[model samples]
Target: MLNTYAIMMVLTLIVITIVISLVTRKFNSSTANFYLAGRKVGMLTNSTAICGDYFSAASFLGVAAAVYASGVDGMWYAIGFGAAFVPVVLFLASPLRKFGEYTIPDFLFARFGRSHVARIIGVVMVQLICIFYLAPQMVGAGNTWNVLVGVGFLGMSPYQTGVVAVVIIMMFYVAVGGMKGTTLNQMIQFWVLFTAMFIVFALILINGIGSYASERVPLVNPATMTVEKLMAGEEGSRPYDQAQAVMSPEAFAEVEAAVQQGDPAASVNVVLPQTNKLHPERTMTFQEPGHRYDWLNQFSMVLALVLGTMGLPHIMNRYYTNPSGKSARLTTLWVLGFIGFFYIMSSVAGMGGRKYVSELSGSDPAIADLTVDGLLLKSDQIMPVLGKLLFGEFGLGYVAAGAFAAMFSTVGGLLIASAASWGHDIYENYVNPKAPEWKKVLVGKIAVVVMGLFSLLVGIGIPAIGLDKAYPSLIAMMVTWAFAISGGAFVPMLLCSIWWKRTTRNGAIAGMLVGGGGSILFIGLNILKETGVFPAGSFGAALGSLAFPSIFIIPLSFAVIVLVSLFGRQGQPPYVNSIWARIHGTDALSERVRLAMQEAESRGRA
Candidate 1:
């Protein structure tokens, strides 16, 4: 069976992960090693590791799926994801590394006059973002397994089995390996996923099924498309016309049967006509905006992703592992290059899906169920499905394994981030300040298990709540939610803390509350509206239309920080000058001095 080859590839990745964890266990004897790999990572290695951390299922599967399903609108996900690192490299990477902390909260606590309030808030935000981000990766895991393995273990559905399997493996490896093990695993995993993406694109080009120039044409026409308009029985609607054009009679019959049943929850894959949300009367096409977002959301989405990278706890934590600020900057440059190439290939793969996947319709009943005309019903399944269609079982196996690699690498970083925040930021500081090193490491490992389980629940609950159906590409949507939250809550506060010496503790806390709190409120309401808890024309639905809240929230946060600092009775921290010096100071000079002293000592000893 095809599942045999895919399962073998996935199993090999797991085995390698476990081996790396076991081999690197000894390096995790101290909190520094466990949390930050002793803060000695080089530029190139750390860049790759950061890439592994940054490119979650959202980038690997979601980006391509977005492109495949939404056409030009989907390409924004790739652009946003790739462009995010620009802000990270320019503003945050060097200074953050130079400040030298184990986690984001540690940086916050130190920067804000050792304020416990700031640290606690930072920890809460980090955990929240990690959970939100982790859920999508878990969803990717389940979806991949459902498509590739097509079976379940121990009475669980195939999706549930995938979720449980990935969580268990992540908990074990992350708990045992610590940052050193995670770093090594992430490095290898990044290359594997990257190679898989490149090969898939290459195959698409080789098969003559894809071309760069063809991306501009409309994927489906509005005139004959059978979407919500057709289902609603509007005047002049021909529901089966578009489906009939591309589908065999057998496939068309199944679609008609599903539509005729009139089950509200049931769905049949059918090409939907695109509308220009920005300009209602204008025509929609593959090359224009409006398939997914209007004018407002187009800008909001970009702002969320660009600013959000600076606020991501796992990503900022990787900067600490760099030996110096300069090295951190260099690492980010490498990351930009690596992810840039990856996103380009992902866009190509998405195009390939649009071009080739429809041909498989009606060839197999099961495959037909997943497609409408030529587009996949669940777009997230594009990578693995495209692989199978391209190179038989071997391509499926390789791409499926790459999907697992993307999840594992990202989930590992998130777990480590979660562990560091809970164990180092909270437990070490407040719970047991004098606790021994062993206890600290043990607690961190425990945190990893707990967070892993939480993510598992979220993953399973997504399908249960009908979220998977509500969104065209759920993984990318959820990831953007996480980005909005992180950007709104942390970016403004971090920018003020690092760049503005006048930022007060109260101001920082207020900014976080407004930015982060506002994001959660808007996103939560959006989810409810999407899920039909808030019916159309309701007040909640009106407010939920602001899908990406970062545009408003980020500026509001910065404004709040400035206003609070200006009006509040409390002034800037007394040691603000020292903190500024440290943040902006050159770590390169000290690193060179240390190296020179070591060289002199070695010569004298010889």
Candidate 2:
């Protein structure tokens, strides 16, 4: 349908992944290597890997799409991603690494002497988040493929087929490579993503500089309400005349009847129904004829990003792979700098989408072109769509490569984390205590394949149920639930173990129950129907839209854990010396941090 660049880019990306994963096979042969790189990663590499993992299909596509669709207010997700890292840096990173556990539950079990509850919760959250994440990625893959190839399956679009293919590929890498494979692959993938972004920016600027079509702009002269002149004389659009302005006051006011109608364009149909209630500008047009800014709430939007990043499981697990607490902290800073730079590039491409394409290509094309099209490219496709428009073959190829790299990188991380939770946290500790190291690795590898297949099924099912449009949006919401639950349920215990010393085992369990359970339960009930469970409706239907139930659940969870811990006699955590070494080990990891990020790691670690 489009061109070969898209297909070629994807093929090259897949080939590289296979090559790299196969090479890293040595590292993945052992259970420890597959799961956590044998706990010996350097700061810079670890941090870069973390950023690669942290930035999911959502960051690559969703955030920019949100900004394009909703305007400046859409930056909340990025802000949340950055904000979530602060707590990790300030509190969690060091103690987590020092605890010397394979997963979060392992720490809970080691500290509290009852690992079952934490193990169950860890597995549950990992499974849920991974599935939520995997579905959108699969949909993204399919959508990309559909655009590159023909919609192939007996009337089913080619895009859907791509999703299945991508998932299968992901299963292969994840099952074979484990954490070692994933880490190396992700590091390389991030670089590809960055390079593709650069190409996209360059191509857009090339077209924009000598834009032969700038003259076709729909200029709105707020003062005269007439055709301000097309950009250097475009051919198609008709000049705004008095007669036309009077009828559609929203877009254009009629010059002839407007004297009688009295600025009739003020109450145009395009404006939202309740625009007057919020702002002084009573004009109801969707695009304020002459103005550039869109009305948006910045406060809560940033709040989400701040909180969401901390809860992200893939990023969190990266800290545990470091050799020392200081290394984990240093890696986080590197991730921040790395991720932020790309965000700047992403925004530039988003603007390019608005300028070059003039329409969103989310699920359909030709519906709304140009301004609305940017909104249509499901959150992940925003950058790629813009690339296709500006660079044509070369640009499209670059973007396809970047997108796959991002997708694979994210999935690879998630699979490893999931494996770590199930294989290391549950299987080794509880299911088969006597299992050998090699055997555990085998089981973990098997778990990756099983989990991946399950993820694929869920991804395909989302579209079948007609909620494909909502997948990206749902992932962000689910992440919030993850963050709120983790922050509320576990943060208190983690803090107590390191600083409070009075936190008791009983309190940790109660808090986990109250915080984790409460948030999960609330989030679960809130999405009951939208998940495609028996198409019901009415006034009661409004309840499901109250989707982010975690808003309420998070605070409740924190309060429960703190109170429970306080009620029981706080006892000192057993791993205090090791935790202290990790949490405050500037000297211990000076050598490790020096290894990867010799210069940059020094200040942040200190």
Candidate 3:
């Protein structure tokens, strides 16, 4: 009964979001406004909008759930996601804006002579990111629906209905609103997301969450029934096959002593000389298990975050919305500050949710304890579920409203960005050079419909995609695919276009092809064949052994770009003084930026 209010609240929020998006179309009706918010968005407003778009289902729900599930390893997701922006600030943002291309491909095409190659790279990368991104958000929407509204359509469950509604709503706004409307919606949605998250987390402190003693998740495998399995393995069996055998003399002696003394616990816990981390490798269980890391995991995660941000097309495109390179940089600084605060709050909220939610501990324990329905559930479902648990139906409703807004705002940005890739970068720029203004607009609108439908299709299967009950881990992997492909493929092109005047057209093409193709093939043939789509034998298993979306790809990409660039002799960057003047600037930038943008708008192909 109470759930109806929660559902209503979310639907209301979705309606509000659509109305707001439709209204923002007033800024400017040209391609620029539709594609880049007319390139005149204020630093503060734009920064907030970026946060709305940047903090996907993963950031909001994934991080907290991870921490709740894993000891120290789970936090890595947040670190990597947040810190990745540092690279964006240092190398990509301002220059990207100044280059003034609508999409990543547009920049590549204009900067290099190979428009076709750029178009191909742009399409592949965008398609991958969009799929990875769209699926999880749909999954999250399903979870939200089940919790807030009850699952019962043709026995279709609330989760399925939520996925349908959310995707439809996302497609609706993206098709109707375009870029200008999307940005405005994003800015508003981010604030609501932050505020709702804050209220729920703050309530946690009042209820005493942070100060609660931290404890390890109870180790138990009801299947097969044994304390050995319960404490250290799976299905009531020992996790290791001696798996505890000490190879070194020093380690062997220690193990022998512990075993002789009949101290199995000590024997299990004993450290081997060559081994790192007191805990040996085991299936990392977070949200039921996987994607685990150590305390420094945050540092590694942050490394990915800062470095990866240098390449994300959606985030990078925001810079171009500003009038000048200077405005672009300033906008990033603003984003960092806003995002930082929100992230800190996210951590607090997660910790709080962990303490308060009993059902998350699999409230129905007699059910065999094998499934999430048996003993506590995955952590990603913790946030929205907790809001309902603690805040009553009304509180759940508020959080759901925020969630709906977050989903719509982000989809709007993605749709607009996708539309631009098709409209400006590929169709208008290459296929139909003579394509008229109305044609470009029509093309963009059509692309939105196509992409939106595809996203809906992807969302349907996401429920079955995860390795465990906590679906966010899969969602995180999906989002990282976009980041990795972008960071690995586009960052080189983006930076080289701006800084290295000597980068040749041939070098750019090589880097794009090699980097993009290598990553795709590696993921498809080796990784995704098992994890994403199909299971493999030993060879495929070996490919799946490595941590995904990791730094492994970074070196290969950068090496290819530099090696290829050095081999060639063309496209050298401009002189230092000229480039410096273009990049650096001063305070009170709004006026100067606006004036510069107006001049560019006045002169452009429009």
What residue runs in model 1 are displaced by over 4 Å at the alpha carbon?
Answer: 209-212, 215-250, 258-269, 361-366, 569-571, 588-606
Task: Name the runs in model 3 displaced over 4 angstroms.
Answer: 26-28, 152-157, 210-278, 281-291, 294-302, 359-375, 464-472, 522-537, 570-606
TM-score rank order: 1, 3, 2
The model with the greater TM-score, 1 or 2, is: 1
Number of the predicted model whose TM-score against the real structure is largest:
1
Predict model 2's lDDT versus the native: 0.60
Query: How much is 132 displaced in model 2, in angstroms?
Result: 2.5
Question: Could you tell me how far off, in angstroms, the CA of residue 147 lies in candidate 3 after the best superposition?
Answer: 1.6
Q: Residue 18 in model 3: shift from native, Å?
A: 2.2
RMSD of each: 5.2, 10.1, 8.5
386-405 per-residue lDDT for model 3 (tens digits): 67667766777787777777
What lDDT score belongs to each candidate, Candidate 1 first?
Answer: 0.86, 0.60, 0.62
* Tens-digit lDDT track of model 2 for 1-606: 556777777788788788877887778766678888888888877877787786666667656564444333345555666556777778778767765667766666655534466557656765665665676677667666655565666565576577778778888887777777788888888888778877876776676622212332222111212223211134333233322433244333323333344453432111112122233465332222112212222332344346544545666677778987767778877777887777766655654655554432433342233222123424445666666666656766777777778788888888888888888887887789788778998889888888888877776776665564334343344444455555545555566655655566666667656655665565555455555452557444545444444455455655666677777664445544543444445644533432433244356556
Which window of ten consecutive residues has the lowest lDDT sum in model 3? 218-227
